[model samples]
Target chain A: EAGVAQSPRYKIIEKRQSVAFWCNPISGHATLYWYQQILGQGPKLLIQFQNNGVVDDSQLPKDRFSAERLKGVDSTLKIQPAKLEDSAVYLCASSPAQSLHFGNGTRLTVT
Target chain B: AQSVAQPEDQVNVAEGNPLTVKCTYSVSGNPYLFWYVQYPNRGLQFLLKYITGDNLVKGSYGFEAEFNKSQTSFHLKKPSALVSDSALYFCAVRDGVNQGGKLIFGQGTELSVKP
Candidate 1:
């Protein structure tokens, strides 16, 4: 089975720039998630979607970060006017049952 | 609030010796614990999970964990360690009730197996 797919394996941008990350969850998976992993830290949940509906995004910084799941299939997470602290890896995962399968992730380096 | 803790930042052992990585968690409802391993520059890979069955659960790559409800701990263990077993291991707990079964992860523990 194909694992969750994410694009732009690496991205480098200056502070105050806008950047977006894309995720394509595994087929037939209803639960999709976005997480941010800083160096030396475990991944932290940014948002979760169940069948195209947002289930939880309380940790998402709505002021600068936004995400959307289209047709319950793929998702996109965006950071506008990114900050220096936004340098980290963005991981996308999908769950068909209890546990989640993750993609390689996109590493964002904010200068 | 549900949370998991990996008290150790790193664990080191020689190959052919037994290895243990400690984890503890606190949550309401079923503990629904899990262990995942992540290699550098790669995503997390599921190693095992503890839902409701036996206190001792076996998983991939010759890994196993004993779930102790009395102590609220789930520790990953391997009878014989291999150099290939080195990676960053994360302990997570599934929130059985709220936030759509969110998985909360600990800071992660790095394991180094020297041959």
Candidate 2:
């Protein structure tokens, strides 16, 4: 079976610019997640969605980051006015059960 | 709040030797523990999880982890290490009672198996 899919394997943007990342989860998966992994650090959960509704997004920076899963199949995460501290890899994952399957991730470099 | 900690920044072991990556956690009640592996520039892949079952849980790629509730620890282990096994490992935990539970991840442990 195919795993979670993400678009734009890599991205580069200047500080204060805006960037967006897309994710397409596994077929029939009920839960989707977005995480941010800074270099040399473990991934931090940014947001989670169960179907079309958000489950948790308490850790997300509401002032600069936002995400949505409209159809419960695909999702998008956006960062406006990006900061240098935002340079990290954005990962998308899905879970049919309790175990999560991840994508290759989008590496964002903010200069 | 639930949180996880990977005490080691990196671990180096000779191929064919036993390997272990240490992890500890803090949670209010019973914890749902997990281990994940990530290759360079890639996302995390589920390795194993301890969810109200046996203390020792085996998972993909010949990996296993022991969950010690008394100590609040879940350390990843393997009998024989391989060069290919070198990668970053993370430990995570969630509050069992929280329906919409969110995983709290450790900083990560980098494993290097030297051939």
**Candidate with best lDDT:** 1
Q: Lowest-lDDT window of 10 residues in candidate 1 chain A?
A: A93-102
Tell me the tens digit of each residue's lDDT in model 2 across A47-75. 99999999999989999999999998999
lDDT of 1 by residue, A22-104 (tens): 99998999999999999999999999999999999999999999999978998999999899999999999999878989999
Error of 2 at A9 (Å): 0.5
Model 1, global lDDT: 0.94
Residue pairs with colliding backbones in model 2 are none
Interface RMSD values for the candidates, listed in order? 1.6, 1.5
lDDT of each: 0.94, 0.92
Q: Is the docking of candidate 1 incorrect, acceptable, medium or high quality?
A: medium
Model 1 C-alpha lDDT per residue in residues B13-82, reported as the tens digit of each score: 9999999999999998778899999998899999999888799999999999999999999999999999
Please give, for residues B21-105, the per-residue lDDT of candidate 2 as tens digits.
Answer: 9999999988888999998878888999998879999999999999998899899999999999999999998888873577788
